[model samples]
Target: MTKDLFGRHRAVLPDWLALYYEDPLEITHGEGRHVWDAAGNKYLDFFGGILTTMTAHALPEVTKAVSEQAGRIIHSSTLYLNRPMVELAERVAHVSGIPDARVFFTTSGTEANDTALLLATAHRRSNTILAMRNSYHGRSFSAVGITGNRGWSPTSLTPLQTLYVHGGVRTRGPYAHLDDRAFIDACVADLEDLLGHTRAPAALIAEPVQGVGGFTSPPDGLYAAFREVLHERGILWIADEVQTGWGRTGEHFWGWQAHGRSGPPDIVTFAKGIGNGMSIGGVIARAEIMNCLDANSISTFGGTQVTMAAGLANLSYLLEHDLQGNARRVGGLLIERLRGVAAQVPHVREVRGRGLMIGVELTRPGTDEAAPEAASTVLEEARAGGLLIGKGGGHSTSVLRIAPPMSLTVAEAEEGAAILDRALRSI
Candidate 1:
């Protein structure tokens, strides 16, 4: 492929655009778990387009559905109802076990999250929101405000008094000194104290499995406890399953199920794998909460025909094949293999997460310190060896996030792990 002429000193690119620090590669094509760069170099996609693409690239069924829908009707204004829209919403509600829930679709995760927040605030007539430290909602202003990552922006804080909950600590790497149980207790205490001292919050949002926050799965019964506390105060629980939803975590159709929680969330936002690769997102909220807001309050493009078709196709494929079962089996094998690799590689501090949503945290020699440099080196070497992964977390950038498609086979899992093991050895 020709060198991009757009990489010049004089360009009309927007000044606000901040490219990812890594050198960009021009990907020309993709298939299941693999993509070819413009130069024809193939890379195994363990990252799965940042943990989206649940079924894989150019899936025949999904493509056929999109094609047929495109041919029939691509766009329908909100003034009229569409079949795909109604069908997808019904399917999602059925699968999620929230029969009375209603869906408000959007084109991306951020928009979905933003809509949820708006609805929550409007319904409760409350100004404050609660979120977990290291949780990632989205990039939009309201969503980013609740995101606890300090890396977002120096001034990016919640407009309301956002309460940051502490679930656990690294105990090694970036959070070496922080204790997990103690931190959780402190957080719970803080929440109780705040509730007793002040007015109730509009909502308390959390990722069932914190994605950008090191893929940390909180202690058992933690989410249930959170739900209990929030419900007591008449506050809504919003599960931001942007990364953990759509059967990626295995053991269940949703990550909240993996938490062993009993009650359902008042509001659940989904994106990423919902449309497989096509852009679509939505909020599934309790009928009561949904009814509090006027229909005219939200604008157009919330439920376009093309996105609804893709979402329907994606959900149908997942259900028909029982891909969640695949995620459980393959994810179990992946964790076992990764743990074995961790035993051999001293730099590997911990292997955490459920099912396909996994993170390998790295540490430095002699000290229980995060080796960001080593993590970067391993990522670079892995890319050189034709494997693709991502780095995330608070301080370390030491978490190697592995979230492949739900359809990734056992053989593919083994091969990907072996290649990653080789890359770790080099580090």
Candidate 2:
């Protein structure tokens, strides 16, 4: 019955309510690439609030925009047009390179994903959806149903019309090396086999870079091939960019663009970093697909005036500062450093992912929870050394996930890497 530092009522909460019980460090404030606890202890933030603070926390531009909008107008029903909403939608479409894209706003990534799911089912007149195994869409009923992780499965998921595709198959042992071509072929084959028995799905949804799935990148030509197959089957290809969008992947404003494909997806969803820590999520859909959706099926708080203002400010920052370029440069250094660290540590099994979204897989050295323990130890030790990191993947809390803000500097990257190195050595 330990009480929180604030003297709030605290008890042994259930796992569902453990998020509140966990004594998260009280971050009093943040700036640039660092956050401070209530005690004024500065910590280098590598996790970047799970990659939501793209432009950095307390960004002056974003803060001003939000403040101004709040002072003037905060909420405007989706029925009425807001200037910021319209401008933000235009910017998202322009950056996505998707012509005639219709935007539908939501309060969070889960809501946006839920809307996308509904649109898919309604447009194609099919209930089935194809999603990548190990993928994490969200926590809502529909979003969770489509999520590939079994740990997120609810008691009644059997009734949902969802199918899973093994994006990356393990051919070696636990630390298997993946052959890109073979993996893509297997995925296509799996989909084909499923289609033979079940009805053609409404859409095939996937994260461009599998975020929670160990930050794994798909095989080359895989996205193009997947789109072709879906088109042939008269199904939509919905790229769930909730985690990979907004310059986090570098090389492109959106991760789908990094696929090096000319044809855009039928629908692309975005959330993290869209408002630079403010609550906002949106879906950009091709005109044809959008036209099919009922206009009345929008969210009440979808395009709040404040959220729109934050989105616009965030987008402006990204475009003006060329944060995407910085992401590429800094991300290259990060990958190199991670690879070097892996080479030095035998327990470090693999280093995977693209750009700033990185994952370090640990092997079972001697402990029963070797991989997970190593990851936890690294995170704890990093925190003690003035850095905050996150965890994800197989064990529901194992893989060391590092997805920093796009605005992070090279020096910060070096410092975070050094902290990681020290943590590994200590562990």
Candidate 3:
């Protein structure tokens, strides 16, 4: 059955679309933190569908809300008033931290980011953008153009003139040898130098925790320092929170809070995890920036009744349960366990991240050479042991990404870590 499905998929789907594992398993269904394959094999879900399942699999509140809303209506274009959409927007605006925030919903992170680009370019009257090195924004033409990661970017032709900046990867760049303070200072100085060489940019967009760039990030307060510089130049700051939003990081409600010493960002984009599995993405900005477009615009299926209902329900459940606090407690334990495991493995280059979003980079034993094969071996071993994980990096995808549901229990963390420890040992 699996072979037949694979054949059919290959015949129809785009070849560029990537899948995990030597033999990709078809996940049939899930509950809480576990999922069953088509062959009746069950495994613990750690990647959470690329971290989209923020709360849990088959969460009751989101399930019920989706069902009831579907019974009433699935969509009614953006022409009419949408109560659920309005409610979700209001909630997002209130929590966005941006004063006088206005929300615009989309169906995916790509579209949300595209909308942000439109706002920034139109408002600032500049097509230039500042994007961090080793960043992956999305797959859209405009997004790919701004992305600095070569593996993910298929074309250099873009609608915007993008300048790659330093500081995304803390340990692999020219400033890797510097301490935290010097690293931040060198990056800030680079930004200042880069700006002097180019025309004034519309905005500087970045991920607080770069999801596809091996879950890497600059030191805390780095962005705040950059914010100070950008503000002096009248540039807007856009935070792409698609993966780092909704308390996944544990220490703060939003990833940008780690750099909030300056102030709130001018705009924020979010998707993945907010709706638990529902297709929900959105952009929140100050009313002035959000309204800069004089012409009319609307998304055919964005903020439809059903997705909004699911998002609203999921958000409520997350807040009521204090999943952020749970993430803080359980994620800390999981990281410590994984750190201990890494110490025993020669190929484990670095273990980093915050809260539930952790990464384990693999390198050739006793060297800096990225060990993509070692990562693959550990991944296969973990799957055989009934555990699921993910891999990503700029250097041949040698980093293991572990992001379980924010509501993960301590026992589940221990169980997942044990399986991972054995998998790493097998390598």
Candidate 3, 93-145: lDDT as tens digits = 99889999999999989888999999999999999999999998898999999
TM-scores of all predicted structures: 0.93, 0.93, 0.99
Top candidate, metric lDDT? 3
Query: Candidate 2, residues 291-391: lDDT per residue as tens digits?
Result: 78666555689888899999999888888998889988999899899889878876776787777888887777633243776777787888889988888
- Cα lDDT tens digits for candidate 1, 1-427: 2345337412767655544225556667889888998779998888887788888888888888889989998887677867888898888888775649888888888998888898899899997898877778888767778888776534555566687766634342333454665545555676788788777899988888878777986665667777788888789988888998888888767777754465778889989898887888888998988778765654367677887888888788888998889999999999999899989998988898888999998888566687888888888888888888888877657788898888989998998899899989988
When 2 and 3 are scored with lDDT, the better candidate is 3
Q: Which portions of model 1 miss their true places by more than 4 Å? A: 1-22, 168-186
Please give the TM-score that candidate 2 achieves against the real structure. Answer: 0.93
CA lDDT of each prediction against the hidden true structure: 0.80, 0.79, 0.94
RMSD of 3: 0.6
Residue 163, candidate 2: Cα error in Å is 1.0
Per-model root-mean-square deviation over C-alphas: 2.6, 2.7, 0.6
> After TM-score superposition, what is the CA distance of residue 313 in candidate 1 from its true location, in Å?
1.2
